[model samples]
Target chain A: MSVREEQSQPAPVEGGSSEEFETERASATPKGGEGCDGCDHRATKPRRKSRLPALNPPLETTQHWFIEAITHPGTIESGMRKAQKIVGRGRVVTDGPILDAVDRMRIYHYAYRARLVECLADDYPTIQYAMGADRFERLASDVIDALPSRKANLNGYGRVVIDYLQRGPGEDGGRVPNRRFYADLARLEWALVEAVHAAPVPALDLPALQAIPIEQWGDVRFTPSASLRILRFDYPVNRFLQHFREDKVPSIPRAKTTATAVYRQGFAVWRMDLDLNMVDLLDALLRGETLGAALAPLEDRLDASHVMAWFMAWVRSGFFATVR
Target chain B: MSARLGFPDLGIGIGLRTPHYRHILDERPKIGWFEILSENYMQTEGRPMMILDQIAERYPIVMHGVSMSIGSTDPLDTEYLRELVRLRDRVGARWVSDHLCWTGVHTHNSHDLLPMPLTEEALAHVADRVRAVQDLLGAPFILENPSTYVEFAGSTMPEWEFLSRLCENTGCGLLLDVNNVYVSSRNHGFHPHVYLDALPMDRVVQFHVAGHTDNGDHCVDTHIGPVIKPVWQLLRYAWKKGANASILLEWDAEIPSFDEVRADALRARRYLS
Candidate 1:
């Protein structure tokens, strides 16, 4: 099969669920709900706790001025305000005469704001590319305002767009409730990201699994492979991500499928079609169960050779690490 | 980095980023030493750490970090230091270093190298922290001076004097960022040469040259471009001061071709050599 076609379909693995499939629903627990809609978009952040007690700050000069410029990012006396010369993104179009800290800061703040916005554009570019600039401009602005810089580099930024889509970090409609379809797309993108840096896992040893006998097949439980992840979404993010990877514009795809096993084979991480039982089986295994222990709950009647063959196939496919 | 890296002698070299990894493996560029980002290799285990090992076999490596946030008032991130010391021993790093800027406070990391005001009280505070870190690491840690876009109105000494006092009190060497000096000089209206000249030259163990954005009023150290001419001039002046500190060229953003980076290294070598 060709590469695209080969990748288009999820790999078939043994031990898939026999029953009907369902996605894991968000369990309603009132405890510490990620208060998404509580924030008003207009946020006053926590006050600055005492720093290393002002090292070389200008005496009488509240370090707050510079901190405000760096964090809040707009205002002339606050670097961003003075910097008129084309800072990175936010605010208006500019020309020159960005002469000092105030101008530089204004521009820097613009640039800084611009950098934050641009990273999202790059990250969800498929979304931006698909959604058009108009929607993207509005949504991107809100996303930027809601998320704050936490890491040294922009690598980990926008990680919360998925969380925001589910529930807000604070209060108010952080576009989380409104953007349901984004979860799948985010999952798809996140899967690709995981694949990019996923740690290497050793392939399965079929013989070791085959060593178990037919009589004990029903008791054969398995541990989740280190490469394994189960992802379920209501949207066709797999297809959307596939298209996006090829530089195609982000457009919606057809009917939703149930959960799939996202696993790494060699250096590549990919999704394989799976049934409900398989997802639960792997989930059980990941929780640290022995093959006998994990399969004990399945309680499915199985012929000796068939069970043995199934376990053998899973091991050959590089699934399951160690049993509890 | 033409001259050697002090007493233990870290030999001469450059920062081993991915771009130069292949080239260094192939051509094996010459210099005194190299500094790697500490946290980058701090994972429980990975290929990044593996590459560090492979590279360390061929050259000396020092640990430089952005996440240490030493100047932070956040009760000394001991967990981070433990990992740092572990990675240092793992790679056998020559020394551990970070900027004097506070990255974040109260466990919230802003991730920017913030500028600290130069004051006696601030200086003393940082010095105490430096001593604490040194005691933990059991090695002399160098603190680099960060570039500033704004100056505090509080009464204080110049940037150089504060850095000098830091070294005098803490026994920490300076990782003098020449480009930062040049950028901050232009932004705050101070002379880059004077800034370098004011610091006690003997205490400077390393020099950093990188690209900065010339945003009219202030030159911000964005580390995106090739070294500017003025910074090169300042480096030439610094070299004239008679200290042979290892020089590191930082080009983090908009990274260019490996050839272009190597060429930039060659250019830096021209001045220092």
Candidate 2:
């Protein structure tokens, strides 16, 4: 299952009902519902009342509670209540006047949200620019609420964002303007990010390609560089990103199929737009089709000169790792 | 002071931040070393890794990580350790270090160095993980004290006691962040000196000095701007007590020119000399 689908499942409540947990938590605190002010002085002082009955829930349950609290989009109090249900209020004790267990949880909640938003913003700058900061942060928060980060590296956190956007903003309970354009922009940005970090590969040298016999050229297969990525979008995302980088607020172009290839060469990332025929040829090559087979399908769609020019461009761009 | 664990006192260094990359590559300034955030270069084969490769050739580099989550309840992530060792070997890092706190529970990563409860159970749990990490890396794993905003009621002892005991148990070394010592002391209402004094000097292999945001009631280890007066004093104190440990200044936010940040890191020379 996709990460989005997996995360959509309701968080499991481990052993007991929420009602029973609430009752136990209520009984642990003072009848007046006013516990110690969560003061450091109070923490140091001996507790007159026996420590609230410890609830040693399973480690996963505690972790779920902790993660749920930080990822929750509701008020801090609601997040705290969720945490208190699993770990008990006593487990989150703090030593400050203004900050209680709930307040401490709130601090963490904000920190987590900030980190997520920062990661998303860093990874998808074009989307952030297109959506504006406030709207982008809201969208980012919704994404975090829906899908808590599942990877150890923050770099791996936002790959599912494009998928999340495709599922539509309805899951986030808010409507986004230019949703399709925004999604396309996100795809473009993520593609560039992937291209930038993709593993390095040695480009096919000219001598190796030239040594192939003319008859065997038809049967030759090509391996694309690790950083090569082809993205097809409804909008001219390649041009949009270019305009965005130039600091000109270009109007979102009308709906048109645009295919772009992003790759890294000499430790620098580069992008280029491609025609439908070229996209088809590259896609065929990516699927491990022989050079003749990949070109045969496009024979009627392109002339020999155009095919030769595109092939030379691809080679010059260092798109292929091996030609055999 | 004698160097501990045979790790050299690489003198003063600054964190190799992105903002200073061009200047660092161009000027090749006279700096002691550069501390690379391991996670920044671990999963990427891009510009950052490329730049790191070039920088490693010029300077003494050490690998510091934030995602080790050493104190988490989850099992050790061997994949991360493997990559860490690879990076350490690639860069010829002198040591690999991460915070002595968990980044998250479960598999989810909050990416913040969340504090651990200073209980005996937690101490044992963290020590075992550190030992495993050390075994995997085939080197003494260094752990740093994180700046915390809250203290758990479940804590059975002070932070220093837990760290000291953990070092004793695992034979791991410490990266004493004086700024974190001061920040946590203020937030938790303890004296920084008392916490510093309680630590075993011989086990300390490094020191971190950084600036923080003073929020009236507490300070946050923001690692921005300049290192404050008190934190510098604490650095001097740690330098005197501990052996000649490598000291690094971290400036992650609102970074200025390379010379300015390097100058801030160079201030440590006055105290060390």
Candidate 3:
């Protein structure tokens, strides 16, 4: 779904707030949380003559101070204004006593910056491309204002971009959908990106052209190729990514349904087309079955010899590592 | 990939980011080496990965990552390791490095380098995990000292002692982040210089220098600007104690012009010389 379409969907549950997030008290303890629960502070005393002494402040005030540091953003202190420009804006420093708005903003910003970029890269790349210098940046700024990241990986920042793109084109919450095929195409682009960094698995090795004996392949359950990805879209999203890289002239995408395949190939990811049967084969393999077993489920009345031949050709492509 | 490259006796280098990419390329400044955040280049194809490859050609690149979350109870993110190995091969990285912290438990990744309690048990857990990581990469690994905001209770020993022993047991080298020392010391109210002096000097194979932010009470290790005065002073102290190793100036957020960043790297080179 496009970011807009996803907006209408309920808030995502993936990696959102967890039930057991660290409470860490309202204060930061010194040395270690001496007498603190769920903390490891068995020995509060320092080692003999170590150059670096343990933290002081008697542990009590230290905890309070640490809490304040994580929670509050001081007023224009420690090159705050200068730091602001370098770190980007909309970082919250004006929140409640426990967690200042700015500190919270920056924490979230740094944490989720990459993920946000992941979600919006395709949708905003045009803006990233056209503005060349900093157009999509504004969207990023607004996106940050609306969505302070809650996750740690900078790559997971855009868990909310789908909704951010859906905000009506009013003012604060208003956003425009721009062109006909842009939104979906942008999402399609993001999928290819998601697949690029998606978990990679050991490629299945086909030793000596299935010399392992087809019978032995039965006990083995095929592992999904780390590069395996399935993308479906209604726009020429592949073309959009190409344009961004090649700097092709911007053109509106035609509204046409499309499903594509993308996978990592020798340290790079490439886009390709997959027939439904191949896609189905991939689906079955992901379910942990052997090639013979996977194809057996297909109702097509093809001869066994024909099916086996087709399977061997695909396996020799070296996409799978070990059948095990 | 090439005879482990062993260890280099060069001076210091800094984290290579986009802001400073041009400067490094243009001048080929006199840095001991450069360390690239491994996750940034883990992708198959992209400008960041491409840029890292280009820079690796000119300098020895160390793959440092924030997402390794080694301290987490998670079953050793095998997928993350494979990608690290892939990137390490591409860059011919000197050694792969990550912090000694848990991002989170279960499957959720917080992205932040959360602090781990300093205990013998935690130490042993991390040590064995490091072995697994080293095995996966087919090279010796380096565990960096994390700049923590809080220390867990019931911790057994001092941070330095724990880190020192960790190297002794794990056979892993240390990529000491100096600015982390400065920021962590202030937040916890300790002496940054003393922290540097306490380290097991011989095991120390690398150093990281970056900028930090201080609130009224504590400091945050925000690699957002130029290295502050105290951190620079501490770097000198670190160099004096240990044999010369590669040091990289990390200017990720307030990335200045190529010349400005090259100037920053040159400034460190001046210290090394």
Instruction: Give me the candidate number with maximum TM-score.
Output: 2
lDDT of each: 0.58, 0.74, 0.56
Cα RMSDs, all models: 10.3, 11.0, 14.0
Output the chain A TM-score of model 2: 0.78
TM-score of the second chain, each candidate in turn, equals: 0.91, 0.97, 0.90
List candidate 1 stretches off by more than 4 Å. A1-9, A12-69, A73-101, A107-158, A168-178, A191-203, A225-227, A265-268, A273-277, A289-317, B1-12, B19-33
Compose the digit string of candidate 1's lDDT tens values, residues A10-88: 4543211111111111110101121112112212332233232323332222234343454563344435443322232
Query: What's the residue-level lDDT of A256 in candidate 2?
Result: 87
Error of 3 at A228 (Å): 15
Interface RMSD of 1: 14.1
Better by TM-score, candidate 3 or 1 = 1
TM-score evaluated only on chain B, model 2: 0.97
lDDT per residue (tens digit) for residues A37-86 in model 3: 21122223332321222332322232222222322223223333444333
Off by over 4 Å in 3: A1-324, B1-6, B20-30, B269-273
lDDT, candidate 3, at B79: 73
Interface RMSD of 2: 13.6
lDDT of 3 by residue, B164-253 (tens): 788778777788788888866765566777677777767667777776655443356656667777777777788778635667777654
Cα deviation at A168, candidate 1, in Å, is 6.7
Candidate 2 lDDT over B229-268, as tens digits, reads: 9999999888788556888998776668889998999898
Model 1 global lDDT (CA atoms, 0 to 1): 0.58
